[model samples]
Target: MRPTILRNIAASVGLLILIAVGYVCFWPVPVEPVSWQAFVPPGYVGPHAANTRLSNINLIEIGDEFGPEHIAIGKDGRLYAAMTSGDILSMDLDGTDQTIFANTGGRVLGFDFDASGRMIAADAMKGLLAIDPDGKVTVLADRVSADDPISYANSVVVTLNGMVYFTQSSTRFDPRKWGGTLDAGILDIIEQSATGRVLAYDPATGNTEVVARGFSFANGLALGSDQQNLFVNETGRYRIWRVDASARNIDVQASSSQARVLLDNVPGYPDNLLRGFDGRIWVGLFRPRNPAADSLSEWPFLRKILLRLPRSLLPTGKPYGHVFAINEDGDVLDDLQDPSGLYPETTGATETADRLFIHSLHARRIGWVPY
Candidate 1:
């Protein structure tokens, strides 16, 4: 009996030794480098002309009124905004007629208008929803699969056939878990896993499919005006990718996919991407470049510590507040910033025929511009 017990113990000890040896030999990912280095790794870009303008703009404080996330403009010149705090709002360009458009009591992240002028929103807690003029809300689709659970539904773009394209920001983390605390370099590393994906929803058929995957941090989706392709903002990798939506072959191996790097490096990390009314692509940028951000996230031990820290205690990127307008190719075209410390930190943006609207999650106000 004693010999039998010793034999079992010996086998367990052997298995433990093998596992330790295997881990040491097989598990070696590159450690986090030294700083927010460049656009690619520890990838930090050198500063260029700040194409950002803090002026041609003014802020609209919605402090206690609403917590706006993304904006959509209607043909009637009314600005529709998704309130992440559980409501939808419509504001006149003048900022006078602010009213509750819908009360879903859920966080609406990205929003767009369809051909029938219905509001299509990507709600974080709820999946995709359609909002009517009377503020009525209907659930279009809800994702329950662990692979695509619509955690941080960041951006939405509607197609002519009533198809909706949007992003589920990150697979490793969600905004509610990492938003306020995503320090410089650590956030970029979380994105390196490239678990982010772009998804499409067809209301006519209630079908949703993963269109594009392997994005560093997929956030925005926009269909080119010519409808030839769609551009997506891979924020973590600091670039935008265009994919073929109308491709014919779909044998998985024969699936048609085309991707181009419109913009590769930037002074600050880019967020949402929307087709501006004035023939340009407007991008929301968060956190300017910093080297320390790299060292803070490079090592696995340090990264685990950083991710566990209370998000509020984490460091925020410099140039804490601003918005940017770039071309579809990712070239900086216009800068919208507030030099003063008035507006909230900007998150998402949308444009109407006459005005450009920007929303911030941590700030008390949204900003607008006369195009």
Candidate 2:
């Protein structure tokens, strides 16, 4: 306990602190983040108030299956779940009669049934694909530009005439190397590069065309009842865009009338879109917006420094559950929530005759509420 002994110990601690600071400040990161003005989220209040309705729902266990990100009702009237294990699960409404209908060997974020009863998936890793009734998988469109490609192919919807519309969540973060789908999404939103796009793939000609571009993180997609419009979720900016389905190319902010914001300044990050039988479109708010992140949106330096720190220390959205239904005019008709978030990360919902199947990004079991 001499002065020299204490001095040496203090010196060692000082050096360690210096090294840690240097690593955090000078480390190179893959994303070159940009700053954008992020509006403060309207907290859960009034119609969007917190409740336990979703938390008390019945859970259909998927055994070891994790991350049932999306659900679909096939032509056969059975439930199909896109699981994190890279397998599309076919089962009854009660979670029985489970079968691995098809394995895409990649993540299927969203899928829909084509007129021919083929399951079309927007695979984050493999690209757009088609799975036949017999479990045969086929790559439909892996890349539009061999150079830049569809980096993060996300939610998809099939038009009655066989056109497939999907969203590429980001052009900067490729889910393949950016540490999976969720990680890549975080990077894209943090970067705010606005490179996300909407695309159309035609099966007849085997061609793909850009429908709309310049989105921060285009996530989910749903066609309008008329099939002439498409609603897309832009996660990074907390908005949903309406794009002209027939437009071959257009920027969201262009002078053309092809693209417009359907719903701006959402309360949280919108994930997926599902058309309910009630003539309303259900939208999933993946995570409640973080106040700290919004406050730092205009501060590029602060965001970049935070990104350089350990991800665990970074500001992130809360798990407060929220989802709502909106009419074609973007009027919110229903808001359901569970502030306790028993089934966290409610990504989307699939409505049927007797129940509403709640989708989650990382839940072990699928949740359902008697509608």
Could you estimate the TM-score for every candidate?
A: 0.77, 0.95
Lowest lDDT block of 10, candidate 1: 247-256
- Most accurate candidate by TM-score: 2
165-238, model 1: which lDDT tens digit per residue?
A: 87766556554555422332246444356666777787877878777776666777778887667788777656
Provide backbone clash counts, one per model. 14, 0
TM-score of 1: 0.77
lDDT of each: 0.65, 0.88
